[model samples]
Target: MNHYNLSSDLELVSMLKDGDLTAFTEIHRRYYGVLYSHAYKRLPDSEEVKDILQELFICIWNNRETINIGSNLPAYLYTSVRNRILNIFKHQKIESDYITSFLHFAHQNEPLADEPFRIKELVAIVEAEVSLLPPQMRLIFEMSRNSYLSHQEIADKLNISSLTVRKQINNSLKILRVKLGTHFFMLFF
Candidate 1:
């Protein structure tokens, strides 16, 4: 039997197209080193370089029937290797973009991690101060602010004039402002 190692590129390609495994193995042995060296120059990552070359060989085998290596198999192999490297770079870029976006999203929402607790604490402080208000003023303030009732609605419900409800709410606000000071409102608003 003739040794496949001595076969020409055209002969190997022909044998590969004819589904000869020995010819494909010989082609892999002949071209793998040059292709790997060429790929490693562009990508320093050893594993990635190996993966690209392995994929290149698999592509050759899988597409052997359709592949037409007319005269220059070396040129074809080099082009294939170069194309695969380009695709790896493209995929790496997309992955890098996704990771950047994810990190930005996490950074942007980081404040939210503390927000709920701060809101709860502020609400408790306000509630404690509200409890210190005289009974009627507290009731009216809760109705207007907490229940979202208008001045007219509070007045009508309490059998008081709209002006009294407005005045009482204003007084309650003044007292709370003096107690809680400005920082609470600044945070909430």
Candidate 2:
């Protein structure tokens, strides 16, 4: 395992603020496993673990704007993650999922073997439309929809702040709404 890096968090964070994705990715990769372990130790079930990690990273990035630190990154990340996890564990019951779209997909008839062509065509169309967006907006827009990852996961993977991810998605959806509003509204049936 790569050990906790000795590079000061201040310097690393400076690199992060400059839109350095590589530096940010490294920091996330280094700490993700440890942070998950910290969360899992406090929370029951492996399922909620992913969501907790997402929230933790999102919170960290959101708070990073005004934060300054001299502490080791690992200790700070681990303790912060643990305290957050314990807090959640103490307060909430894990409610059953009420969404049934997942069940709909699970029971749907399997597509024909070559039916993937339809997906490819749809992807091409979406990509073409997304490409017309402003640059950063375009990247975030597609990353949110094309990948199976959640918004926070996309933010972590792209090393952009989660706020940026949410903003981008909001912007993209609004544009899409304007472009397809009547069409979209007609689909509720």
Candidate 3:
């Protein structure tokens, strides 16, 4: 029988600190699924969830020399995952606020027929701005917004991770926000 199979997390962690590859592999085998599931619950994007988990493990490995988990490894993992999720949410909120701000500006300043006309203009602006995105980001953005595909759907179709699909979409939005600036409100109100 493998002693590692019966070893406590603290023991495995100590071994990991000593640069034990087998111990690290064992830890990965033990917790990767649990961590992945936890991340998926908070983030619907599978690719993002995978990335988050992968990053967590990679961080652990890279920092193994200095890593310290005082007996509660599961809690440590959960906390790390939670923090990453919070950061992702914070970024999403910022992007959402940009959209909200644009809407408010349009509501306050634009008129009846002007609203529709402005929408058309905004569509044009978005198209032009989207064209400016890197090819992959633009493709993902269009797949999501124009083709109305879900992240998982896009990932499957593109043979990429859903996380990559989401990141590209977010990047595209950020670029649009910056390029369109206050003018976005004039286009989409």
Best by TM-score: 3
Per-residue CA lDDT of model 1 for 118-157, tens digit only, reads 5555344434454444546455434623355667976776
On the 0 to 100 scale, the lDDT of residue 167 in model 1 is: 79
Clashing pairs in 2: none
Clashes of 3: 2
Clashes of 2: 0
Compute each candidate's TM-score over C-alphas. 0.47, 0.41, 0.49
Name the runs in model 1 displaced over 4 angstroms.
Answer: 94-189
**Number of clashing residue pairs in every model?**
0, 0, 2
For each candidate, the alpha-carbon lDDT, in order, equals: 0.65, 0.55, 0.66
Query: Best to worst by lDDT, what's the order?
Result: 3, 1, 2
lDDT of 1: 0.65
Superposed Cα deviation of residue 110, candidate 3 (Å)? 42
Candidate 1 vs 3: which has more TM-score: 3
